[model samples]
Target: MGKALIEKGQIYRNEEAWELFSNLITEITPSKVFVIADENTNKHCLPYFLKKINFEKSPEIITIPAGEIEKNISTCLKVWEILSDKGADRTSLIINLGGGVVTDLGGFVASTFKRGLRFINVPTSLLAMVDASVGGKNGVDLGHIKNQIGVINLPEMVILDTAFLETLPSEHITSGLAEMLKHGIIQSEAYWKRIKNINRENKVELNTLIWDSIEIKKAIVAKDPFEKNLRKTLNYGHTLGHAIESYFLENPNKKTLLHGESVAAGIILATYISKDLYGFPENKLQDISESMFKHFPKQTFSKKDIEAIINLLIFDKKNRNGKVLFVLLEDIGRHKTDCVVSNKLIFRAFEYYKNF
Candidate 1:
């Protein structure tokens, strides 16, 4: 059996996650406890979370429709209604069980309802486990712009169990792996080498990789929790990636892109920008571009599509002024944050991605 452990705010391994949940609910002793799941997690993970850990009050369960599209004020209103009707007070505890959408939406609801309520995160997907679940960043998108409305508030605890990945599809795993690669690109050469060579079929190896990712994230958040500077490196590919994700999400005629799939493209474009602007090594740029293409093959973007995606960057919450900003690399494992890129420069980067 894999060992169960707790460090910082993370409860590692499902067995320990169960123990940690059982203990936390008991110790906090809230007037009520609630578990929030999307329709997918309600079907896939909620039963297991319920059976593995017993709750003192049977815990009220709330379900939202699954998908990023459901993340909005409408959903938050519904959650608020449920909490108000259920008599959940300031001392209530909410456990968010699912992927990025569920945790992001749930965290926002718990933090805003009754002014504030304690909450825990039980991330059931790779994206949530590595990035969304820990950062205390919670919010929903505003139309084609991602994370337009949210708060920076930490959860009471987070439970991570790779077992959740058993039922996760390969495409989803690949999506999350994009973020893992971003972690490596921003911080460590060794991590990048290990990640690019990973056998996704190897569960043991994947688990270790996930643990390393969480540790890297933890270190970054501890030093720059508010995203004042260093934590911005985490946004390496997100500025353009989010625009791409949102564009596909809005355009039904095109193939819908997953967040990671979009990020993979964004990373490539950003890498090109890094090469052009920051003197990043051309050989390494070519190598990473090939590696990224292995997981995320090049996608054809029409001039119109590129135009819309670039327009969407203006709404990026990271923007300090009206200028569009990006987190770019000085080199792999070395990045500079808050660099403004011109529209013509961005267009050229996209062109490079397409032709390469």
Candidate 2:
């Protein structure tokens, strides 16, 4: 008999991730395959992947609109309908292809379809590969809330292809960079140094960096798969980052913030507050902000708008009881989790961003 294969049943990463995916799928050989993607990934990523993989059969391709706004029950229902029409059954498999939005919605769709089915993630963006691709955490945004509804269904495999990143716009590339920066802050100084030097003009080296970021996430998630402990540290920039994203999502007239852009702003605000309240030091905060300024330009928000965003944060899923908890920085590569900050400090965070 062939040697017994050991399946860790968790996330995997490498430059050859796509090749690994092709091999794994060939071994499993599901009856039917579904490839879920957003409009952007369909145009730039899916065609290349189809040509590379030796699928037992041609997979049904389903595409959804690309953006946070499209991540909802409406889209989820459409994906379900597509799976139904394609005769998707328990024996079928789903391969989610795209950014965080695609993985989030596609995972939700796969988890709920006929109770559940095995799915794989071929995360194409840096943000998705680093953060969203690792955790079993999957969900869709609610009205104004980001990731309000979700499930925890780990993928059968995750294919991390940096080749797809070559097609990403500079803005999208920088957006994903914010998450990498966040991961470095929360995980390792060595990683932070590696990321601090990445430039918008450098496109050939993203594949290696993306894998490093994914490895950071894997170490954290493997230790706290359900997000009950150290995993909360991953929210380093997301507390305020999520609020920023929702605020822009609500106000159509204002410039829309990409997931990483909002997080970049969130990191700046959080670090400033960390200095003000937690003795993190003003110099450290300034250094972080200055580095981020290279990629994310400072966005102006009115005091009223800032307060409104904080108000929405009160309803965040991360909050315990009525108080909103912040993952504050002590310094880069270090964070204090579940630290409760007062409205005064929260307002101060906004004040800092105003000047920043």
Candidate 3:
């Protein structure tokens, strides 16, 4: 039996995952089924997925362009049109088989189309497996901003298969590690230590860490499903991270960064801020910065670039009463939410990042 992550959804893993998924299809007996994948997963993951389960009828394949840039209202409109034309109703089921972009956009489309269609998230990337797919927070970017238009609707189930990670690039694997690292920083020091020493070549260890990361997220979401308090801690690195990601994404001159790469940078900056404001201990701060830099190469930002990134912070979803709020740390596993930081201090943090 699959373990329930929330009241509405359960997580199925590895050998048991396929058997449970097959059972689910029989139980739902949806009017029609749709499989949504980006170009990459369509080529790499869909074939394996199709072979594992037998659908009553052939699933309609909806392929979207791959990459973060393709996650938007325009893409959502295209998916919605496809769903409408293909006769997807409330009784239909959608299997989102890809990374965060596909899972997020597909979930949103399923939630909105015909006032909600049953959906399952088959997260193929490391980023999706541990974070995006597990959370039930689904949405797409608005312009250059991250996750601006979205919903907090749970999927019917989440199928996590580590086999799909073999299809990802090493950099992408590193990208996923950032969130796992964040899980450690905000939740457990032992987890942080274990994650910091991860040897990617060790498959058994890697899979165990992945499950552990999911449990950490599950515990947090269970307590604060609406992000009223404890759940806000999950955004520790994302506040500044999203801004940095948006800036690079919108700038033609700079190389666009993977979501985790930017978050790694955000974690470092936030740690510096935490140390300065709440006495979060400089030694741990140094440790975090060093570990992050080890996995993610430093991204250079000119003064003008930094300014634009700072400007994008105003659009962050965590803002309250027109004020930008952040989730900062007092120590490992100790966090404070909705804190304010001055521009001068932010600038100083950037200087620290640049110099380090």
Every candidate's lDDT:
0.87, 0.82, 0.91
Q: Which candidate is the best by lDDT?
A: 3
As a whole number from 0 to 100, the lDDT of residue 266 in candidate 2 is 90
- Indicate the TM-score of model 3: 0.98
Write candidate 1's Cα lDDT for 1-356 as tens digits: 22233343554565756676677666678999888999888998887778888776698999999888998999899999999999999888898999999999999998899788988898999999989976799888787568999998888788888888887888898999999999989988898999988898888999999988988988999899998999999999899999999999999987878889999999999999999999999998898899899998688898899999998888887898687789999898888888988888889988999998
Task: TM-score each candidate.
Answer: 0.96, 0.94, 0.98
For model 2, the run of ten residues with the poorest summed lDDT: 1-10
Question: In model 1, which runs have C-alpha deviations exceeding 4 angstroms?
Answer: 1-8
Give the Cα-based TM-score of candidate 1 against the true structure: 0.96
Clashing residue pairs, backbone N/CA/C < 3 A, model 2: none
Query: For residues 1-356, what per-residue lDDT tens digits would candidate 3 score against the true structure?
Result: 43232335667798787877887787778999999999999999999999888887899999999999999999999999999998888899999999999999999999998888999999999999989967689899999899999999999889989999999999999999999999999987899999999998999999999999999999999889888999999898898999999999988988999999999999999999999999999999999999999999999988888788888999988899989898999999999999998888888899999999
lDDT of 2 at 97: 91
lDDT of 2 by residue, 226-301 (tens): 8786888888878889998999998977888899999999998888888876788677677788889988988888
Task: List CA RMSD, all candidates.
Answer: 2.4, 2.0, 1.5
Number of clashing residue pairs, candidate 2: 0
| C-alpha-based local distance difference test score of model 1 | 0.87
Superpose all Cα atoms of candidate 3 onto the true structure and report the RMSD in Å to 1 decimal: 1.5
